[model samples]
Target: MAQFDSKFHDMTEGIRAVASLADAADRLNTIVESYGLETAAFLTVSPVYEEPSKPFYVTTYSPDWVKRYIEKDFFDIDPVLRHGLRAVTLVDWKEIDLSDKAVRTFFGEAREHGVGKHGITFPVRGVDGDRGILSVTSNENAAAWQAFLKSEARDFQYLAGEFHNAIGRIQGRPRHQTVCSDREIECLKWYARGEKVKRTAEILSLSPRTVRFHLDLARAKLGAKSLAHAVAIATERGLFFQKLF
Candidate 1:
């Protein structure tokens, strides 16, 4: 039981206000692991506000799929992303049909990557801001998944909402805004390990000067008074993945 709470404590420490999109995705992935999910995503409504729109912000997606989705400009016609923006409840992916040629193609690729047929998407709507969706997915059977959701859905949604709000505030938006990168976080993680500039540089294959630059950027984004403070904030906010130094 102590071990169980320790896992939750790790989660609580790692989900901080990230300054990059990749960092946000990484954090969501961490949460997904706790629930035995293979994948999770947070998709937000685009500013277009037109018919058949898609989420402008979709985290931790395959680069290939994201590139294709953007190249094809699918947001102009994706039914799921459209419905997701307006929904205020958890929607099962299987319930939606994508018989259209384009939709089928896109979803087919996602399934090929093991996204699974069963999924639950939590729709988060904000008043006068960018609405968002936090979805957890697995290959588990639909009925069992639904039962689990019935028990834990509201709490998960509430937490997702709070996380969404925090991300928005950091990005200077009321709704959703994209920020953060993998490298920035990688650098921060080294800092959290108590590595000095030169040492962290050697570990990351970056120059000592480059290490300082990334730390500076991290500090500014986290509103930290110093490097130590930034590390503390990141740990408190769930930004670091490894054991804290």
Candidate 2:
């Protein structure tokens, strides 16, 4: 029990030591390998809806497989991704519906590219509506895979949550605000100061249409529901008036 506790503590510390996305990716790969898995992936999605924002993905998948997956737009038909999006707990790849032809084809092709024959996925939902999935895969046979999962599933789930939080810290606050542009920030700032779009545009020497465009972009980037919401989020993130008072 003491040995297990110490090892778990070391694992957590290793994940927390990740200083960048690249480092996080490497650490995740190492963690999976330690469990005798062949590959692992971490994917984060914003605005969890039909057409989510561009997902952030880091994986030990072969470059060829990754390129093919992207070119074929396989995300739409991937059973793993579909299940991960809706599942609240750990998901065994076998639990996904494989009756669909597209799903079968995806798995067949993935296997041909050296992807694992068995895997488990952990789905996470953030307080702010962000979603993420962590998957670890192995080429082992069914019996061995099941036995391994029985022993390591709990640790894998813990590591998945740790990886997500580490990524959040590396990404900084208001995860969506990482994409806010200068113009968007300026528009939000002026709007926060009680300026209308027209007045803000005049102050910035731009057209009202242009000002509204920036503000709309800011709202979208910040995942806010409205202009007031956008300004409020930006203000909370200290994104407004960075140079001025």
Candidate 3:
């Protein structure tokens, strides 16, 4: 997995301190801005297996645009929103065939109020029929946007899950307790690779006892009966990223 940087460390810490959904949405915007994206939205609806609920959103979209969207009942014609609700993966704007006149006009009106020309939406499905969307927009040209997506798609997808889980907790839904700390993940990475406690310590420049301590914390948070089981849980959730160079 990737070596944790100070900026990423700061982000994890910030989430831990998030006071409300609006705070978390703002944090989401800040993270995307570093990638040259302009704004973001987090939406909650129902998964296809269940009946849909009135969608709720925490977004950086302009108030006028959001109001217009609701007043016009735009979700009925919103290609992005319609596809995103049932999408299992990241949905690039270009992937949707926007040949319909109504769909084009909807997005065109959105741009007039501040929506970016290009965007991507990540669908996050949670337990108890909970479904969420994390969408970010940018004004970058196709080539540059493609390059950004190639390198960052996985990261944005992970962020969507985090946002969904965090909002769920705030809304009284079941909370995911398996979110590991940076150091906890680092120790787990080595352990997953079959490193013994001592070797893992050397790899992280820490004492063996310290490495074991972090591993134990990770194991407990994951509610795994063993360290290996914890690693398996993390792997299943795609928790690990590329290792440091």
Cα TM-score per model: 0.58, 0.66, 0.69
Better of 1 and 3 by TM-score: 3
Candidate maximizing TM-score: 3
Model 2, span 1-245: residue lDDT tens: 11246666677789878879889878877776677888899887765554656677789899999999999998888878889967756789988888888888999999988789898897766646667789988988889999987666655655666677677777673432234556668878888889988899899998997686667556755657788888788788777666245
Q: Candidate 2, residue 178: CA error in Å? A: 20
Native-to-model Cα distance after best TM-score fit, residue 212 in candidate 3, in Å: 29
Candidate 2 vs. true structure, TM-score: 0.66
Q: Write the per-residue lDDT of candidate 3 for residues 1-245, one digit (tens) a residue.
A: 13445665565556656668778876877776666787788888755676656787788888999999999999789888889977765688878887899988998999999998889997766756677888989888889888977666655665676677777767767776435556777899889999999999988899997686668656755657788899998788766673222
lDDT against the true structure, each candidate: 0.64, 0.76, 0.76
Output the better candidate (1/3) by lDDT: 3
Each model's backbone clash number: 11, 0, 2
User: How far out, in Å, is residue 124 in model 1?
Assistant: 1.3
- Best to worst by lDDT, what's the order? 3, 2, 1
Ten consecutive residues with minimal summed lDDT in candidate 3? Answer: 1-10
In model 3, the number of clashes is: 2
What lDDT score is found at residue 198 in candidate 2?
89
